[model samples]
Target: MGKTTGFMEYDRKTAEERDPRTRIGDWNEYQLPMAEAELRKQGARCMDCGTPFCHTGILIDGKDSGCPLYNLIPEWNDLVYRGRWKEALERLLHTNNFPEFTGRVCPAPCEGACTVAINDPAVAIKSIEREIIDRGFAEGWIVPEPPQTRTGKRVAIIGSGPAGLAAADQLNRAGHTVSVYERDDRIGGLLMYGIPNMKLEKSLVDRRVNLLREEGIAFVTNTEIGNDITMEQLQNDYDAVIVCTGAQKHRELPIEGRKLDGIHLAMPYLTQSTKALLDANYEANINATGKDVIVIGGGDTGADCVATALRQRCNSVVQFGRHPRQPDERSEDNPWPEYPFVFTLDYAYEEATAQFGRDPRQYSIITKRIVGDENGHVKELHTVEAEKIPAENGGYTFRDIPGSEKVWPTQLVLLAIGFEGAEDSILVGSDLEHKRRKVKAEYGQYTTNLEGVFAAGDVRRGQSLIVWAIHEGREAARECDRYLMGTTRLP
Candidate 1:
């Protein structure tokens, strides 16, 4: 609501990008920054609609509108429009603990649901938000704000991804001693590994981790619970324990030739490549050099695989998905503010299309088998045509088309079918009970069956967006605080 006539005056302007060729040469962020003047214009585009769904952050029609954390979007946009960059950053950080991460990685569900998008293009909210934070960093306004004093109570978090980190941030702000534990050699779970450095630079995560450390939020890497330390010890050592380990068990494709060497889980492949790039690895890295790679799955992770393979000098890269090609525009089924399924090119796909003759995506493809070479390594993928059959139930089923099988030339096949739940490595003797072995936490409660234990994020809710994880973390922290203390003030 910066200006009544603002939405009419400005068109949506997002940040530009570095040339694909130049950006692909390195494993860092490629999104170019917008000049302050242009950014101000973009800020002015905030119509501040009467409904203002941008801050609602609710899932309407199965899509997210506004910031899930209820970021003060219009207020900050007004601040940015008036050239008060520091104030804008303050407003951005008021609710969002890590705008730096979300500003870049989030799918911007808010913009998709923006009221202006009904007739005109939505405001460049994400870009302007990023601008606010980057300007804060440039002005040295972003600093570590550790707790002034510590309460007698102590807490332990079992993961360092956004969920755990968010919980620690809240609990520590509540004056409790907080220590995070991660099984990986590094602190971040998926943030440090599952995502590629090119998309979300590892250094960015490291920057925040370093600040968390400086703020006295103890982080213990390589100290996995239920292994390095016992769950009983954790329950007794700390007043409360929170499990924020992300859902990492990738759904398997138990098709023919499933054990082929070249076919690997998408996350592990992405993890290995990131660890190699970050020197966080002391093991053999997965490389796609001089290989024709077929990454099965059309999600962001699969796209990252394509980008990483290109950096490793892959001969060719092709991606496959069972879903049919979506319409270029949002369909009636995909209405406002809910996450709409539409055909849009991500950066990785854009780079691949620019370098290769065509876009690397093959829609309506269902891999039936992994074709292998003489040495037992996968050399190609056997796929069949697939169709979406609307089921009697709400969910649709994938129907295979007869005689549509074909072999796709490939040396590496990465499955990015998404995660199932938290790895079973840390569940033993944790006092947490599982309903059918799934984390048994009530929706919105986030409390596990075990006493004094809570779960959130992908661990509790399964694989989801960073925004949802952060939301759950915040809610879980509040619940934990209430359980620990007689009353709570956390929002």
Candidate 2:
């Protein structure tokens, strides 16, 4: 620990955000930086307990408790508290290949598992991490470090998301020639498109990609395997193949009027919006301008859609969730150390409440049908109030209440329910086995049924956080390294 009673002396403080009204005008990040001194004080709040659970990468009740990337949280916290930012940056990069991404977007489960959180507020780990990395970038400390020698073994990675990029970084560090293939025009699969720019700017993604390029990792964009290039060619040419193609197969709400013209999936809508922003041309974009939008689903994607619609100057927005409202505090059944199931206002909900007089979320409501006009454009949405009932399989099912049907005007609807699994177009001719829509690979090994074939990230584990994807990719690279040589030094 940097200070003996630092945890008691200093209270946890985090980064502030720009006014919602001002931030909504542009697609830039809203987080305002904290002074270096306040950030150091926040870092000093880390108790650094003897048995720190912040770094333990374990799952309790099937929810992440600690840092999934196994980041040296306490070590870095102490380094930051002592003003040893360069050492802190090194420690942050030891496990996480891209702290910039996680520091911005990760939900920060480490705070949930913090020892100080048992009594008072947890340390501002995410904010401290962001400061360390941002400072590193500003001071020109973050530069590409290519491997000293090449192993003469070429490896191919499909889908250039967090997992693919992480695996490529590790493999390159292990002296392997790594080449990443991305179907999209840009390298980041989900980071570049699925996520909105206000939360994480595209420039940050490009910065990391440029650093990877300097590290001797080849990024092949607009080229897909099994289509532009054959799977057989990959197997023959590359010493190993890692499939990090994220779960792009979005889940659909195939209900009444499902094929309506004004309805769309969340990813394509989000992707198109980002593309338009990048091109500096707003015409012919999938925007919610001058429309009353209804976003279906209650997860992060739905929240993102809500924010995106607000930014596009939508007249009104309502987000629907099928389940009941979560409690403000954790119940006995949902104790601490597991992901807190309590209700907290995300950025979108806060923005909506600020702009409009009320929160835009409507819980315990199910979409019955999408009402369309004579011209086939979506005009309104019909919904019914629902309640959860105990099911025979120890689960709950929604039961619609009679005489509770209502209709609301909406010109556009975005389905942000969730992803199903990996897309089939790329995996059709591959040798990898699959379960449901996900690629069949074990947790630690990350190997497919075929020899020398590996899978990771959402493709293997289903939809998850970016930190988990990085962890999976790193482990997969270690396994791949071991497979290539009798012994390996990768960690």
Candidate 3:
């Protein structure tokens, strides 16, 4: 829907990032904005394929294939290409509640599934989306639009993550009185603290949250539903409760020296670091300064740990991953429209390489145990080189190689192994049915065992992407609206 021949004429380009060496010195956003002319050119790269899979929002091989929020990529790209920034922003806001967050953090499965990506580089849809929203804000087009009328229905959303915020926004727009509860002292659950400020500036989160406040959504911070307020009181206070507390129970490493000092979970470390930064303390509770750091795991969390360690001025850093390095290009089993299983340097790796003279990732490595000093603090990390072996059930497992065990000196270890599920505390007093440690609510319906109670996001679906969380939140809000009003009009 963009310029007819633009896809063939212009090459795909994205926003340039600040130099890794320079950006690591502080906790500011690393990405530098793309010029309006270049952004329009990137937007023009959207091809007019008969079937645009960029927004299909489907799963292929258990991987995200496109925009989980089903964003109007083509329409917005066309609008951006035609210089209709306002129209593009409107179309973008129709699907995504927070493009600023996704644009900066989401892995951009939409680009991976883009039609243009079949033969060449994909359109820079994420960058164009961010520009539209940023421009909207700059032009003062984005503002609080509280519902003119109230339906007298009340919905209490638990959690202030993207999911909870999205649900609150949609429910509030539906003329329902919505109150969001966050256990933390501030709003924006993961957005406020779990993520480091370098990835997403907290001010941006506060900006949107302030807009939501003006839009008539009541936000109650430092209030835990099951603790500060019981489920009974919550049920009596609101017509419905949507749980979006997220999968926060981190997976533990129950090996030797597990309880040693100087080892911490990844989320708490990130949270403390960001909290300290926001509080102007400029010192994290789990400071990595002048220490040898070892990160156990891979993916975004591990990478973030590596970057945070570097920013904290750690002496050295290394990350362990059980899996082998990915191939330079997609393999036969990984075809088009399936999120490409290929290797590319992430921002954290770039910063680590720039600072340390090499990438910090050590693949095909398994942590055998943690060795502590006499003081009971972490002194060394024991590991062994491993290889992936296919199991009888068609799954894969790692096998440690003989005579490959080694010990690396380290004072701190960060476990980014991932999360198990939602914390059980939230479900203690309620009879909410659960499976696989997550709330057992069907995807579309989002209804729990208790009447007038709902669930969504990571708490309901297990650990997932921010985009998926927003999608579930929007859908759950729609379903809740239907239940509240009988007939619904929410999209």
Which scores higher on lDDT, 1 or 3? 3
Candidate 1 regions exceeding 4 Å error are 280-283
User: Tell me, what's the RMSD of every candidate?
Assistant: 1.6, 1.3, 1.0
* lDDT tens digits, residue span 1-491, model 2: 65668889988888998888788888899898889899878888888498888888788968889898889998898898899999999999999999989999999989988888887888899999999999999999988899999999999999899999999999999999999999889989989998899999999999999999999999899998878897778888899999999888999998998898899999999999888889865554477998999999999999999999999999999999999899987788776677677798888888898889789999999998997999998999999999999999988999999998999999899998999988886568676788888999889999898778899999999999898999999999999999998678989
Query: What is the total number of backbone clashes in candidate 1?
Result: 4
Instruction: List model 3 lDDT by residue over 1-491, tens digit each.
Output: 98899999998888899999999999999888899899888888888889999999898868889998999999999998899999999999999999999988888999899999888988998888888888999999998899999999999999999999999999999999999999999999998888889989999999999999999999999998778888778899889999999999999999999999999999989988888888885666698999999999988899999999999999999999999999998899899998888998999999999998999999999998898989999999899999899999989998889999999999999999999998977867567889888999998999999899999999999999999999999999999999999988988
After superposing candidate 2, which stretches have Cα over 4 Å from the reference?
281-285
Error of 3 at 282 (Å): 7.6
Clashing pairs in 2: none
Predicted structure 3: lDDT: 0.92
Model 3: runs farther than 4 Å from truth?
281-283
Please write out the lDDT profile of model 1 over residues 1-491, one tens digit for every residue.
Answer: 56678889877889998888788788878898899888888888888577878778887755566678888888998888899888888888888888888888888888887888887788898999887887787788978888898778999999999999999989988989999998888877888898788767888788888888888899888887877898778888999888898887779999989898888889888888877777754563578999998988999999999999988889999999889998988899887776667899889988898789689999999887776889998877788998999998878999889999898888788898887776777665466776533577886788887788899887777777898888888888999899888789898
Tell how far residue 406 is off in model 3, in angstroms: 1.4
**What's the TM for model 3?**
0.99
Cα RMSD of predicted structure 1: 1.6
Give every collision pair in model 3: none
